[model samples]
Target: MALQGPEELGEPVEESEDLDDQDASSISPAEEITLPPGPGGDEETEEALLLPWDRFSAWLHCICVVGFDLELGQAVEVRQKYPPGTKTSICYLSFPDSNSGCLGDTQFCFRFRQGSNRKTSLGCFLETTDRDAPPCLKQGHYYGYVYFRQVRDKSLKRGYFQKSLVLISQLPYVTFFHSLLKIMAPEYFEKQEPCLEAACNDIDRWPTPHPGRILTLPIMGVVLKVRIPTSYDKPGTSQLVQSAQRLTPLIVVSSPPPPPPPPRCFYPVFFHLQMLWELVLLGEALVVMAPSPAESSDTVLALVSCIAPLRYCSDFRPYFTIHDSEFKEYTTRTQAPPSVILGVTNPFFAKTLQHWPHIIRIGDMKQAGEMAKQMKVKKLKNLKTLDSKPGVYTAYKPYLNKDEEIIKQLQKGVQQKRPSAAQNAILRRYFLELTQSFIIPLERYVASLMPLQKSISPWKSPPQLRPFIQQDFMKTLEKAGPQLTSRLKGDWIGLYRHFLKSPNFDGWFRNRRKEMTQKLEALHLEALCEEDLQKRIQKHTEVETVDLVLKLKDKLTQAEREKLPVHPGTLEKLRAHIEGVILTLPEDLQGILHKPTTL
Candidate 1:
C-alpha cells in the first residue's frame, strides 16, 4: 500500500479531528494487549506509538468477538480488544444476538446508532457518519459498522461458529470493509490475535483515502482497488471492482459504485424498484426479511444507499435479530415504529415487526440470468400472508407513477444478456436522476433567495435570506417541479410536501442557509475592498474612521473564524486595503487602530 516502514505506524502524532466526541462514545474499553516492538522499535517508541493497538485503532475502533454462547443460551461478546482510552458503555448499540445459521460461510453488514450520550476523546480517525450532516458539526448521532461472518462448525454446540468483527467508523464504506473482513476474519478465526496484529500492520501502510482517486488497499496479502466519490459524482460514475476471488479480499467501492451487491438485492424485488426508492427517500420505516444475515444486511444497505447524494437522515440496521438490545424497543406494538429501516433473517420478525408500514420479504437471490425472466411485482397482504411468497408488502401508495421506460430498459438489458454490472448501472443512474428531479425545484427556489449584488453595501450588514414560504414555493412549482425532468408524473407537489416534514429536508435546508449566509458576508467584504481606501478614510471623522476599521476587522475575524467560503485572494486584497487605510490615518488614529493588532 505504501513504501513506509512499520515505524510510521508508531510515530507520535496528534489525533485526527474527524474522530469527534460522539464517535468516542461507541469505543468501549478492551483489555490492552502489549506486543513486541516492530522491526526496529525501541521501548520508548513502542510506548509512544502503542504499537499494534495504535495500528488497529487507526482504521478500526476495536476488534470484537460476538457469537452464540451455549452456556448462557444467548449470543454474547466473548472478547474484545480496544486501544488505551477511558472506558465508556457501548450499551447504546443493539448488537446482533444470533448467528446466521447458513452452511459454509456467509458475510453481511449492519449499522447502529450509538446512544445520545456524547463523550469526548483523542485518536481514532473515523470519517463523519453522515456526509450530509457531519456529527462534529451537527447532532451527536454516530453510526457503527458491524461486518459479520458465520461459518458452519460442527465442533461448536450450535453447529456453527459466528461472530462479527465490528468497525466503529462513522464512514459508510459498507462494501470496502466487508471485503477486508472477508480476508481477515477467516484468518482471525484460524490464528486468533496474531492475525489481527498482522492485518492492522498492513492497514497502517495504506495510503490516505481521498475522493475521486482509485485507492489500492492491501490486507493479509490481498490487494483491493476502489475509487472514493467526489461531490460532483453522479450514480454509475464508478464501476464496482471485478474481484477474481469469490471471497473479495480488498475491494473498497465507496460512493456511487454500481454492481454485484446492490443490484443482486434489487433483482428479487425488481418490480417494486421505484416504490423502494420512494420509501427510502420519504424516510419510511422499512423492514427487509431475507433468508440469511448476508442477504438481510445487503438488502438494507442497498435500500439506504438508494437515495444517495440526499442523505437518508433516518437510522438503519442491516442484520437485526430479535435478540438485539433494541429488539423490544423497536417491536413494541403500542408506539408507532420510529423512522428506521431494519433488516432481519429470523422469521420471528415477520410477526414481531408486522406493524411496520413497509415490509420487503425476499427469498434467496437467484443468479442474475435466472432472475431476468421472473421480474414481476406481486401484490400480497402486508404481514398475514407474508409466508406465501417473496415480494413487497405495504399499504402505502407511491407518489410517482411507475416509470415504464426504466422497466423496459432493464427488461431489454436482460433480454440482450447484458452483464449484471450494466443492468446495475442503469438502475443506479435511474435513482440518481430521480433524486435530481425531486431536488431541482427546491434548489431553484432556494437560489432565488439571494439578493441582487447591487443591493449589497460595505456600510450595511449582510442581507438576510428572504424567508422560505412553503405555499409561495409550491405555487412556483406549478411550472417547475420534479415533473420538469422526470418521466413519471403524479402529485409532484405532494412529494415535496412530504419531504418537507423529513429530517433530511431540515438538515439540507440548514446547511444551504448557512452556506448562502457565508456567501452574503463574503460579497459584503468584496464590495468594501472595491472602494478607494484613502477617499473613504478622508470623508469620515477620526472616531468614525476608527469605528469603521474596527468593524472591518470584526467582519474579517468572523469570516476567518467560521472558515467562510470566500476566496483567499479576496481576503488578502481586503486585508491590504485595510492596512493602507490605517497607515494613511493621523498618528493618534493610527495608534488607536494599532493598539490591538495588525490586520
Candidate 2:
C-alpha cells in the first residue's frame, strides 16, 4: 500500500479550545487548582480540587501523546493540527512527529488485534527541553494535540488520541511524570539517572542512533537519548551506573549469525577409468612390423598384423603407413620405443592415454600367463592352443619333409595299435616317463626362477623376458619335437574356429602372428603374478598393443589403397574379430589391450 504524507494525515481545524487564556491566568485557574502545603501558601489546610478542563487535557495527552507503545510496533509523527480546546474528548490536536525533532529515529509497525476489529499503528516520539518555551508547562495548561491512525487493507482508520498538557511547567516533572514512570517504575527511574544522562550524550551527535535503546524494549523501536543526571563517580558506582544505563534508554540487543553452505559430489576413479578405456577402444588400431626398404609391403604387413585386429573391434577404422625406411629414420632420430612413437604421432591414441595410467611392468608376463591358463581351464577347458590333436604326431613326422609322410605315420600308428590291455599299459608307462622326463624338469626350472623373480619389483624391474623365451625356446622345442604334432587336439574344430574368429587371434596366420602371440603370452604371464603387477602389466600392454595394432593398421590401409580386395576384407574381418575378443577379456586385460593416446 502507498504511504500517506504529513499533509494527508489530518484535516486542519478553523477553531480550538482557548488553552492560551487558561494558561495565562495567574490566580487559581480552576476549582481544581489547589496549591499544596507550603511555608507561605495558606494558614489552614484546603480540600483537594478537581478541574474538569485540566483533567481532560491530562487524560487526552496520556492517550494521544506522540510517544512509543512498547506493546505495539510503529513510529510516531507528531503534527499539531489544532490548538487545545475545552472539549473533554478533544482538547489539543497533534499528529505523531514523523521526524522526532532531536530525539531519535523511529519506524511505523502495524498490528491487527484479534477480536478488537482495530488495526493499530504503533511508534515512538522524542520530546526535547531544547524547545523555545520553559522546561515545562504549568498545571491546568494545554500545549498540543495528537491523533493516530492505522492502515488496514489499504484504508486508514483512527486508532488512538493524545493531547499535550502542562500539569507542571518544569522539564523534570514533565519528563519524569509522563515518560519515566510510563516507561519504567519509579524506583528504577530514580536510580538510573546517571546512566540515562550518559546515553543521551552519546547519541546527541549521531544522525540516527544505531542499535538504539528503544529497540531493546518491546514495540518501542529505538531511543536516541534521554535527559538525566550523571552523579556516578566512585568505583562501584560505575558498575551501578553501567547496569542502570543498560536497564532502559541504553538497552542493547544483538543479532544472530548466518548459516553454512552445501556439499559437492564427484565421480569415482573406477568409473573414470572405464570411460577412458572405452574411448581408447574406439580410436584407430596400430601395429609395428619389422622395418623394410619396400614401403608398400612393410605397410601392408603392419596393417595386416596390427591395425586389422583392432579395426574390427572399434568403430573408427584408421589406416596409415610408416614405411620401413621412414620408420628406421624416425627410430634412429629418436631413440624412444615404437609404442612411444605411435602414441606421439597418433592423436587418438595420445588422447586416450591421457586418462589411462601406464600398467606394463617386469613381473606382468608370468602373472598374465598364469591368469590366461586359469581362465582357459575355467572357461575353455575343452579347447587347446596347439599340438594336442590326434593323428598329428609320429617319430618320422619331424624328419619327413612332406605332409603325406605325417599322414602316413598317423595312419600306421592307428592301424597297428596294440590290444586294449597292452595299449592301456603302454599309455600308463608313457605317462610316468613323460612326467619324470619333461614335466618335472620344467617344474624345477620354474621353481628355481621363483625367488629371483619374486625379488623383482614390478615398478623398478625391466620388462619380463617371457615373450622372447616362449617364442624362441618353446617354439623351437615344438618345432624340433621327435614328431610333427598339431598344436591343438581333441574335438578341436570348435576351439580352432573360435580362436580363429576371435579378434585377439587376428593376423595370427601371418608372419606377425608369432610375434603377436609371443607378446600376448608374455603379457598373460605377467598378469599371472600379483594382482597389482597384473594390473600394471595390463596397462602397459594396452599401450604397446595399441602401438602394434596401429602399425598393422597402416598396412591394412595400404592394402585397401592398393585395391587388394581379398587381403583388405580379410584384414578387416580379423580386426573386428580380435576387437571382440579383447572386449570379452577381463577389465585388466582390456585396459592393457586398449591404450589411449598419450599427452
Best by lDDT: 1
Candidate 1 regions off by >4 Å? 1-58, 73-100, 115-149, 152-158, 202-253, 256-260, 263-268, 365-382, 411-418, 539-550, 581-599
Reference-based lDDT, residue 207, model 1: 52
Instruction: Estimate, for each residue in 343-392, the C-alpha lDDT of model 2 and write its tens digit.
Output: 11122222222222221100111221122222111112221222121111
Writing each residue's lDDT as its tens digit, candidate 1 over 301-357 gives: 677667766767777777676545678889999999988989886767777787788
TM-score per candidate, in order?
Answer: 0.76, 0.15
Query: For each candidate, what is the lDDT?
Result: 0.61, 0.25
Largest TM-score belongs to which candidate? 1
lDDT of 1 at 490: 87
CA error at residue 65 for candidate 1, angstroms = 2.6
Report the number of clashing residue pairs per model: 1, 96
